[model samples]
Target: MASKLIHAIYKDDDLVLQAVKQIRDARYHIGEVYTPFPVHGIDKAMGLAPTRLAICSFLYGITGLTVAVLMMNFMMIQDWPQDIGGKPSFHFYQNMPTFVPIMFELTVFFAAHLMVITFYMRSKLWPFRKAENPDPRTTDDHFLIEVDASDHNVDKLTDFLYNTGAAEIKLIEN
Candidate 1:
């Protein structure tokens, strides 16, 4: 089914919170909210699920660390096996101090690159990505709420918005 958006352009944080409260009171479904900056208590007002990004980030970091360790160990011990400068050949783990720099570099390299890619993917942000915002001003100045109306009364929705201090309200098909 095609999604619908009940778009409201709010003037300030107060208006945003007021709308959020109205929506909660009426028990309306909200799809997403767009704001130039965070509105304090907005999430609580919307009753949004806490983001899982932190868990995903930690998992990605651990994966990067594992990759780094495996690659470094494979290259240094198995690939070349160089006895350069008379360093231990078979078990460099004896001194192990020498491999610290390589391990650190690989870990940092993998973590930095992988984290960037993972974050972008998780956010669905990529190059040439043009987002659909009903009012460009919302991206700069206004606060916006995009509510998902589920076969409900449009007049009632507008009435709720009016009561909640929404400066402007429009509907968009998403």
Candidate 2:
């Protein structure tokens, strides 16, 4: 049988938290949540694990450092060695100060560019991908709660939603 997704839309974050608290306290399964703006502590309340973005960020930073080192080394030592001042020679590691700017720029460059790419990939945002939104209004001013229930508990779910302060209730299929 195909699964059904029931979404209860709310306008306020506090109501969402309260409804989530009720469902969590009663041991109900929440499929997911959608919010326009991030509500602090919602993830914790939903028992979500911490993300590994930090690790990805570190790896991206290392990629930047590697690019910077290799590029500077190639230009100064291997490819085109140019003498800026007579006091120093055109050696890369020997003239470490000259590579500082490249290093800094690469670090920032890799972090920002790669971080965005990683985020988009992880979110499955690519060309021609079907959107996952149940309600278009959710992207602007609504918060959503998705619950899984069969015909047996649909009424109960809707009642709970109405009693819990949902602005609107709708059943969606995915």
Candidate 3:
């Protein structure tokens, strides 16, 4: 099936943000926005739901912590029980303070790496993936807002986009 969309180009991030708010306030359905850099609060302006990446990060961190604890316990307490610098390795609880650094580092490592992987998966971004932006200029200096033009009057939408300070407008059919 083919669809029609209006691409509104803005030169400044602030203008794009304002245009997004105006578009939403005017009851227009925005398909997406492509910008050169992250615009703070653009997701809120677009009425997008909050992300759950933080929850994923927390779970990954817990997994790392558990692995660190188990590995430390097995290697230090169970596998080769030893006395180093007068600190006994017979009990995990008694020697937990010495393992704190490992636990913390592993937890952070897992959270950061896994969160990045989760974000890439969630965004469907991977190596050799084709770029989806309609305008390549959006990757450099411009911001583009894609509006669904299916059920709306194209002329009116163009006028609205112009009023919202769009530097350029294009109607694309897909």
Model 2 earns a TM-score of 0.87
Best of the two (1, 2) by TM-score = 2
Q: For residues 1-174, what per-residue lDDT tens digits would candidate 3 score against the true structure?
A: 668899999999999999999999999999999999999999999999998888999999999999999999999999998999999886899999999999999999999999989999999999899998799999899999999998889999999999999999999998
Model 2: per-residue Cα lDDT at residue 98: 72
**Structural similarity to truth (TM-score) of each candidate:** 0.74, 0.87, 0.97
Clashes of each: 0, 0, 0
Q: lDDT score of model 1?
A: 0.78
What's every prediction's RMSD, in angstroms?
Answer: 3.3, 2.1, 1.0
Candidate 1 structure quality by residue, lDDT tens digits, 58-172: 6666776677667767777878777769876686475368767766676667667777888789788999999876678888889888877758887888888877888888987
Where model 1 places Cα greater than 4 Å from the true spot, the runs are 1-4, 81-90, 172-174
The order by descending TM-score is 3, 2, 1
Taken over the whole model, the C-alpha lDDT of each candidate is 0.78, 0.85, 0.95
Candidate 1 lDDT score at position 18 = 80
Q: Model 1, clash count?
A: 0
lDDT of 2 by residue, 1-174 (tens): 877878899999999988888877767788899998898888888888999988999999999999999988887778877777853545666888877988988998998899999998998898798988878888999999998875438888789888889999988765
Q: Judged by TM-score, which candidate is best?
A: 3
